[model samples]
Target: MTGLLRAEWTKFRTVRGWVLGMVLAALIIVLLGVFTAANNYSSCEGPDGDDCPAVPLGPDGSAVNDRFSFAHQVLDGDGEVTVRVASLTGTITYPPPDHDKIVPGVVPWAKAGIMIKESVRQGSAYAAMMVTGGHGTRLQHNFDGDAAGSPGASWLRLTRAGDTITGAESADGVRWTTVGTVRLAGLPPIVRVGLFAASPCDLTVTQGDLGGTIGKCRLARAVAAFDHVSLAGNPWTHDDVGAMRGAPALSQGAFRESGDTFTVSGSGDIGPYGLEGGQPVERTLSGAYTGLIVVIVVAVMFITAEYRRGMIRTTLLASPRRGRVLVAKALVLGAVTFVTALIAALVAVPLCRRILRGNGNYLLPVSTATELRVVLGTAALLAVAAVLALAVGALFRRSAAAVITAITVIVLPHVLATASVLPVELSQWLLRLTPAAGFAIQQSVPEYPQVTGHYVPQMGYYPLPPWGGFGVLCGYAALALGLAVVQLRRRDA
Candidate 1:
């Protein structure tokens, strides 16, 4: 087994053309991923009142939406804060297409309520208890923890004990129901605790009968009135002394406090935006994933090239066990491609962000762990696809035939599903059942029911869980490898 594996690896590395093809695959991943992200710049609005015009976002920008607004006060040390939210309301404003400018519609994941943040800075560590315009009550902490559908309690509280914060909700502020708990490590002695509002304006455009989501968007404002105001910390002095009393920014929007009543309103995003950069940052390989075409090519050639050059006979003679020989080849291909693709994915993610920032645009918020998964998982994704391609190539044993079949069977389905070329349902099934399911590995933002967006593949949303999708891809590769082994034993070398 070891000898057979060594022989296959030697043959693969010794051929300069094959080595160059592998290098080309990595270069393609980086160049395509980074340059595509660099060219796309996304600017979001908070208090500025700016928004994305109803224009097409080309290929890279359509699936991204990350904007929100927040208003908070800094409090020193650990203490409890509770507030009764009288109402949570929002309105979606269409920009002049229809005569009716403001529509009574709440975007999915429109959140308004109380929160405790390590800082007011975007992407800082925080925990929130919010009432969605539609999805009921939720207790979300940081970028990943979400405890949604907690009985629609209007009065929310965040009690901190050292690094741990417990989120509780109540109907009357008397009976508190524990919703969730989270630990914010290195929480500064002083932290921001107050009200916030945000909405992800998913722009759904209806062209005649077909309603296709053109942009993951936001063009709305969420307003909430909080009374029964209570605090256990120092009174947060809001600065803006010379800005006048009736500033529209303060009167109609932002935060206004009078006695025990506080009205908070904002427009922008709060939660961590889904995987990839919200609007500005394109992470999931964007054009770089097209480089998988090169990866597939190299993968198919891994075996077909041997068959084309009549080297199969020598390979079989060197390793008499046909099944063992196939396994060795698969192992070699999977390992090498895994390393190459991993390097490409890691390089592409950070580089893409740098380029996007260079253009004065910022990526949506995502956790450090999620970032790691995207980079590492993309590599795993490519490795799995490459192995699957190799197995399919072995089954066909013809370079052209294998390459064409692999593309038709694997690559096309992903492109059609991910690019919105097919119906969302059909695309989801294709991803669920096909090797292209491997792409789920790179998804950093998980689909939350509370958050509304196109959870379909075209918008980079995967129906299957990341590991689950990857598992399905692996299953197909395993099945293909099994069939290839059987064929190698029966068919002439």
Candidate 2:
């Protein structure tokens, strides 16, 4: 096996064209990545023509929206905050056919009720038991965790003991059921417990005349009236966490108090940042798609060229075992592709990200671990794709036919799915079943069912989870390799 591998590696390296082709693939990845980043720009000017503030980062280091209205009082230690949500109402701007008026309505996921937070700062640790406009009662914590309770429960409570917080909800305030319990690690001794309300922007997606999706987001706000506010402390203080500067007076966050009733009005969301107003880290790696094509061509030719020149007979005689010869070639091709692509990806990601930030674009923040996954995953994707192409080349023994077959299964599906030419459902299915599923490994932004947005392939959402999709592609490659092995063994050299 060692001798066979050495022979295959020697053959690949001695061929100047093959070595140059690998170099060209790496160059394409890095050059196109830098070009894409340099060309992309974003303008988020405030009402006064100044640059907008940076997006907030959650505790987990992902971009998050934490704007809301809070009517809170400081709690010294273990305590409980409870309130009855009387009603939830909101106004939508330019909804649908009439794009000229502000109408009274609540978008699904508008939230209001009681919360126990470490502080009033945006993206702070906290747990909230709230009633949403359409999702009913939910216990949400730290920008990502959510637990559903009884539907349409009007009363909510959050009790904090040490670092653990328990959320319970009730319909009449007499019969209560525990919604959820979460531990807010490192919560300070003094915390803010209060009544809060928030709503995300209203999203409208329509079909374009040319078989594409058109999406628009309009500003929206939610108002919730809470009665029987139960908390013991100083006079209630109101703050709009992460408030937008110079926003319209009607959309600004504020709270009104009358006796024991507190009415809070707020805008923005409290969850994962969806597909809007930011560029993901993977955006810088857009060149991977183009580089994969080059890799496919090179890998197919590596094997098919041997067949065309009638070198396979001599190669099989030298090895005596055809399967081992195929494996040796695949190993050499896969290793060279992986190493070249890895070097290109490592240079492209950070360099392009800096360029993106320099161009005034709000690059979505991701953790170091996630960024590493994206980079390594991209290299793996190219390597596996090359292996698949080699297997197809061995199966067909024709470079053009093999290259076409590999690209159609691996690249075309991704293009059609992400280009918005097909319906979202069909696009998702294509990503799921085809070798293009491997592209899911590059998705940095995740789909949160709690956040209301178009989770479509066109918007960078994949149907399968990252590793799951990669496994599908690997399965196809393995099957192809097995069939190629059988054909090589059965046919005369």
Residues 152-192, candidate 1: write the lDDT tens digits: 68998888888889988898789989888888877788887
lDDT of 1: 0.72
Judge candidate 2 at residue 428 and give its lDDT. 89
Best by lDDT: 2
Question: Using Cα atoms with residue i matched to residue i, what is each candidate's TM-score against the true structure?
Answer: 0.77, 0.96
Candidate 1 lDDT trough over 10 residues, lowest sum: 55-64
Q: What overall lDDT goes with each candidate model? A: 0.72, 0.89
lDDT of 1 at 344: 77
- Residue 119, model 2: lDDT of 89
Which clashing pairs does model 1 show?
A: 67-268, 67-269, 68-268, 68-269, 69-268, 201-217, 201-218, 275-445
Q: What is the Cα-based lDDT of residue 482 in candidate 1?
A: 96
Clashes within 3 Å, all models in order: 8, 0
